[model samples]
Target: MRIPVLAAVLATAASLCSAVPANAAAVWEPCDPAPLQCTSVAVPLDHARPHGAQVSLRVSRLPAGRPADRRGTLVLIPSGPGNTGVARPVTLNLPPEVRDVYDVVSFDPRGLGGSTLASCELSLADLGGLNPWPAPDGGISANVATARRVAAACAGNGGDLVRSISSRTEVDDLDRIRAALGERRISYWGISYGAYVGAAYATRYPGRTDRVVLDSLGDPDPDRLARGWLANTAVGAEDRFADFARWAVAQGMAPDAAAARELFLSAAARLDRSPREWVTGNTLREALRGLNTDAGLPRLGQLVRVASGGPLPAPPQPPPAAALQNLAAVATATICNDVAWPRPVEDYRRGVADNRARYPLTAGMPANITPCAFWPYPPHQPIRITDRGPSNVLLVQNLRDQATPYAGALRMREALGRRAVLVSVDAGGHGSYRSSGNACGDAAVTRYLLTGTRPATDVLCR
Candidate 1:
C-alpha cells in the first residue's frame, strides 16, 4: 500500500524498549522504562543459509496485565518489502481488552532498525525536495527521468543488504524470532504492504499462526504484486481526492462539493496550458502531478490558500535519506523483481498517454514506467500468493485509501476465500481501525483479536 515504503522499510528503524532487559534471544527481558521493555534476538541474515550469518533483531513488548488474562503474543508485521514496523506495538494505542489478553510484541526486521542498517549514498537533492510527480498537464518526462536517476543511484550504491532484503526473507526471519521467543504460535496484525507479508507468512506456515489480520493488502499475484498496486493508485487517488474536494467545498471554498470538484479540475486543466510557479520551485502542473491522492492534497491546500489569499498550507518538507532508503527498497526489490516494465521509452510514452486519457486524476503515475524498466536481473523465483491460512483472518479497510484502495482490498478478500472476513469502514484514510475514526470498527477488530471470533459475514462499519 502506498508503495510499502513507510510501513515496509521505516519499520527498519526503532527506539530501545527502555523497560526491558537486552538478553540474547531470551523471553520478556525487563527494561528500565515503565511502559515498555526490550531485548535482542539473533536470526540468520539470509534464510537460504540460515546457519551461515546472524543479525541481531530488537524486540519490544508491553506485557499483558494480570497473568490470567494474557492469552498469547501479538506480533505486528509492517508494510513494504522494506517498511520498518518495529515501533508499532508502542504506537498502536491498543484497546484495553486486547492489552489484557496479549503481550503486544514487535521487532524491526533485518536491514531495518536495531538490526543491520543500509544507507544509499544518494545526493541531498535526489533525497529531498518535493517528490517527482507526473505533470498534471499530462507530461511524465520528468518523473520518468527521475525514476531512472534514483534507481541507478540505488543499484550502484545499495550493497548486499539490498539484495537480501526481500519479503520472503523477512517472513522466514519472523518465524525464527517466534521460535526464539519460545511461543508455539503468534497472533499477527499486518497493515498495507504488511498484509502481503502476513499472507506470505500465513501461507508458508499455516500451522504457526494463531490469529492474523491483513489490514490493507497487496495483490498476491506474484506476476503483478507491487506493479499492480502501483498501476492502480490512480483509481485510489481520484476516489479519495473527490472526498476531500467535497469536504473542502462544503466546509470552505466555492460552496457545494459539486462545484468545488469542477473548480479543482478546471484549476488543474488551466495549469496544463499555463502553469503557475510556486515558492516550492515546481509549477502548479508539476505539483498536481505529484499530488495524486488525499495523502498529498493537504499540502496542496496550503498552496491554494496562498493563491486565494487565505492561509497557505505550510511548505512541504522533502524526504531525508532515512525515508528514501525504504522507498528505494520497495521500488527496487518489488518493481525490479516483479513483471518487467517495457523497455523502449516509447512504450512508457504510449502507456502514459493512454492512461492519462483514461484516468486524469492520477495522471499516469499508477501506470508510469519506473527504473524497473532497466532492471539488470530476473526474479529468483516466481511470486505466489496463498489462500491457505487460518479462517480467523480479518481485513479492515477504508472505502477510500489512496495508497491501497478498496478494489485491491476486495481482491485480497477473494484470494483468502472463507479464511477471512471483510469489514468495510466508511472512512477516508490510508489505514483503518485505530488510525481511522469509528469505535464500531475498533471494537469489532478488538473483539476478534481478543476472543478469536469474527463476524459471520462481511459487514460494513459506518
Candidate 2:
C-alpha cells in the first residue's frame, strides 16, 4: 500500500540529514573529447547501509567560459531515469551568458552510462514491452504476461544494483556530487523526469540549493509517482496530437485539421488490423507522441502521408543490445522501486479500455500494465515535495507537452506552493526553455538563473 502525502513528507523530512555520507571532493582529470573533464563518485548501493557495497557514478563537467564571472556550479540533471547526463555539459544548447557564469556539471545516474551497470538481460521481445504499449485492440493480457516475465528476469539477474535504482537514490547521489564539487550550494536545470529530481533535491536539501529551474515537469504527487506519469501520457498525447494535426493540414497533408486527425486515426486503425513488417499501430502512436514539436513537424507529416498508403520509409536501425538491456533494467527498476503498482490485472484492463475510448491516439497504451506490476522489490518511501524549500525554484512548461503535459505540471506547481513561480509558454512541445524556442519562456528562466529573480507571480508567455 502507498503512504499518504503528509506522512511521506514527514518521513522524508526526518531522514534528510542522515540519507547519505559526507561528500568527498571529486578528483577530476582531463578526459578524451577536449573541454569535458570527468570523474567518478562512489555512493553506497543502498543508503540505509552506507558502509556496504558501493556504486560509482560517472561525473562530467564543462567549466565556466568566464571564470572571472563564475557564480557557482549549475548541475544539469539528465531527463530519463534511464538517460545519461555525463555529456550534457558539452551537448546541451545552453545560452552563452548562463555558461559564462556557472561551471556546468552532469552525471550518469547509477545503472546507466559509465556508472556501475546492471541488466535483466531481457530478450528483444521482453525489451519491447518496457513501454507497456497495449495490443492493437486495446487488450492488455499480452502486456500483463510481458510484465510478469520482465519482472522475473530482473529479479533473477539484475542483482543488487538494479534493485537499488530509484528517484530517491538519484537524489542522494546528486547531493553526494554537490559535496564532491565542494560547493556549498548548487544551481540546477532539470528537464522532464529530471525536473522531479530537482524538486526532490530542493525539498531534501533546501539549504544546499540556489537558483533552480524545473522545465517540462511531471506530477510531483508522492502517492502516484511514476505510475501517474505513465498514465498521464494518454492525456498528453491527445493535447499534442491536436498541434500535429494543425501542422499536417497547413502542410497540405489533409484538407483541414479535422481531416488530418481522421487521416492519422484511420491509418493507425488499418495498421492495427494489418501491421507492416516493421510498422504497427503502436509505432505510429509512439511516433506521433515523439514528433509533436516544430522541429519534428516535417517528419511527422511525411510519416502520416506514407501511412495513408504512400510509399513506406525504411526502418530505423535498432539500438545496441547492451544499451537496450541497460535502459530497460534501469527504467523498469526505477519506476517499480519508487512505488508499488496495483497488482490486479483487472485494474489495467479497466484503465486501458477507458483510455482507448477517450484517447484513441494512444490506444490505451499509456495506461497498460508494466513490469512494475510484478516487480519483486518493495518501494522506498516516496518523496513528498512541499513548500518547505526555499523560494528558489522557477518552473517553465510548454502549453502542450506530449510527454509531460501542462496539466500535470500544474500539480507540480501546486505541490511546491509559494516556493515556485511558473512560466507558462503558449507552445506545443515537450520542453519549454531553450528547446521550445520561446523567447519569452527562455527569458524568464534565464533571468531567474542569472539574477535570482522570478516573476512576482505566475506569468504566461504567449
Candidates in order, TM-scores: namely 0.84, 0.94
- Model 2, 150: alpha-carbon shift in Å? 0.5
lDDT of 1 by residue, 335-397 (tens): 465455567777777777888778766556566777677555555453365567668788898
The number of the candidate with the highest TM-score is 2
Q: Look at candidate 2 and give me any clashing residue pairs.
A: none
lDDT over C-alpha atoms for residue 280 of model 2? 78
CA lDDT of each prediction against the hidden true structure? 0.67, 0.84
TM-score of 1: 0.84
Question: What count of clashes does model 1 give?
Answer: 31
Clashes of 2: 0
- Model 1 scores worst on lDDT over the 10 consecutive residues at 15-24
Q: Quote the positional error of residue 214 for candidate 1 in Å.
A: 1.4
**Residue 175 Cα positional deviation in candidate 1, in Å, after optimal superposition:** 1.4
User: Residues 51-106, candidate 2, lDDT per residue (tens digit)?
Assistant: 76566778889999999999999999999878888889888889999999999999
